[model samples]
Structures are given as structure tokens and as C-alpha cells.
Target: MCEANAYVRQDGVEELFLEGVDKVVPMDNQLYLENIFGQKKMIAGTIKELSLVDHKIIIEKI
Candidate 1:
């Protein structure tokens, strides 16, 4: 199962939103991933568009 992870973006601060994620669904640079121990996290990015087709998740990052 694919799950979303949360991120905190602050001014003058840069961080890797997705790194070493276990459940990473790495396609189109979109991650439906989870933590290392199979824990579900809150959705982070602002989703403008979303679609699920052919076992894929397409989203527009805002």
C-alpha cells in the first residue's frame, strides 16, 4: 500500500521531503510513500489535480 508523507517547508530552509522512504511509489517524481516501519503519514503537498489509472497516481504539485 502506498501512503502519503508530510513535510514542513520554511523560508530560508531547504529539506528533503522524501528520502529513504520505504513505500516509495517513484514515478513522475510523486511519492506515495511511508515511514521505515510501515506507518502511514499525513498527506503533504498541495494537490491541484489527482488521478488513478493503470496502477499509477498522477498529481499536480502546487
Candidate 2:
């Protein structure tokens, strides 16, 4: 329940990228997102914001 949903901010809008994200790993200039269900997504981007209270993780694509 502590897990947060990840979003990608684009053109002044936030789009949901992943739900129940548990971890984020950065390697080889790419970001790896792992959800509670072990679903993974790798993308080229930078972390923009972490709103723990709101349970949101925002990323901006490179």
C-alpha cells in the first residue's frame, strides 16, 4: 500500500506510466521501473518529482 503510481509529464499533462511501482533503478542512462507485481519498464528519462504524500512519482522523458 506504500507503493506509488508513476507518471510521465508531457506537454503540461501527466500521463500514468505504471501503477503500484515499488522500485526504480538507474543504469546505462536508462531508468528501470519495477512494480509490486514485478512488472518492469525501462525508459530514457529523469525523475522529476516524488510526491510521497500523494503517492506519485513523476518522470520527464529525455
Candidate 3:
């Protein structure tokens, strides 16, 4: 229930990247994201914002 949805922002638009993200790890130049369902993704971006109250995470591509 504490998991959050991740989004990628581009050109002022936000797109859903992943849902139910439970873990986030920064490795080198990429960000690693994992969901509660065992889903995983590695993205070349930086964190833009994290809204814990809204359960949202925003990432900006490099």
C-alpha cells in the first residue's frame, strides 16, 4: 500500500512508466526501478520529484 507510481516527464508531459514501484536504486548513470510484482526496469534518467503524499515519482530523461 506504500508503493508509488513512477512517471517520465518530457516536454512538460507526464507519462506513466511503472506502477506499484517498491524499490528504486541508482546505479552509475541509470536508475533501477522494481515493483511489488517483481517487475523491473532500468532507465537513463534522473529523479525530478517525489510526491509521497500523492504516491508519485517523476523522472527526467538524460
Candidate 4:
């Protein structure tokens, strides 16, 4: 999965933005991130921001 800070730019909608992530995070599925905190400490939500930057994508939950 392409994980990165994807900047969702909407033409006539609300813009979206998220931090460095690690999942495409489907709108219906979800996007979760992990750090030194551990696995269970990750955040899950509907993906919002969807963009492709050099084959990498930034995803955020709705």
C-alpha cells in the first residue's frame, strides 16, 4: 500500500489533508497507522484524502 502525506485537493469540495500514513485506506474499509507506541495504539477511520504523488498516495478517514 502506498503510504504518505497525501494532499486531497477538491475542485468544488472541502480540501483534505493527513500526516504520513501507511495505507490506501479505502473509504468503506479504513486507514490505520502505527509508530513506536505499538500496533494497538493505531488510529482507524474512513479514508478521505485520495491523491497520487509519484506512485505514492496519502489517505485519511472520513
Instruction: Give the range of the ten consecutive residues with the poorest summed lDDT in model 1.
Output: 49-58
Pairs of colliding residues, candidate 2: none
Give lDDT tens digits, candidate 1, residues 1-62.
44333343445343435433445444444446666666543343443322232222223343
> How many clashing residue pairs, candidate 3?
0
Give the better candidate number (2 or 3) by TM-score.
3
Q: Write the per-residue lDDT of candidate 4 for residues 9-44, one digit (tens) a residue.
A: 345444324444554423235544442223322334
Residue ranges of candidate 1 with Cα displaced over 4 Å? 1-7, 14-20, 25-32, 46-62
Candidate 4: the clashing residue pairs are 6-58, 46-61, 46-62, 47-60, 48-60
After superposition, which runs of candidate 4 have C-alpha atoms over 4 Å from their true positions? 1-3, 12-16, 27-62
Expressed as tens digits, the lDDT of each residue in 1-62 for candidate 3 is 89999999999999999999999999887899999999999999999999999999999999
lDDT of 1: 0.41
Whole-model lDDT values for every prediction: 0.41, 0.93, 0.97, 0.41
Q: C-alpha displacement of 13 in model 1, angstroms?
A: 2.4
Best by lDDT: 3
- What lDDT is reached at residue 38 by model 3? 99
lDDT of 2 by residue, 10-57 (tens): 998999999999999988767899999989999899999999999999
Off by over 4 Å in 3: none
**Steric overlap count per candidate:** 0, 0, 0, 5
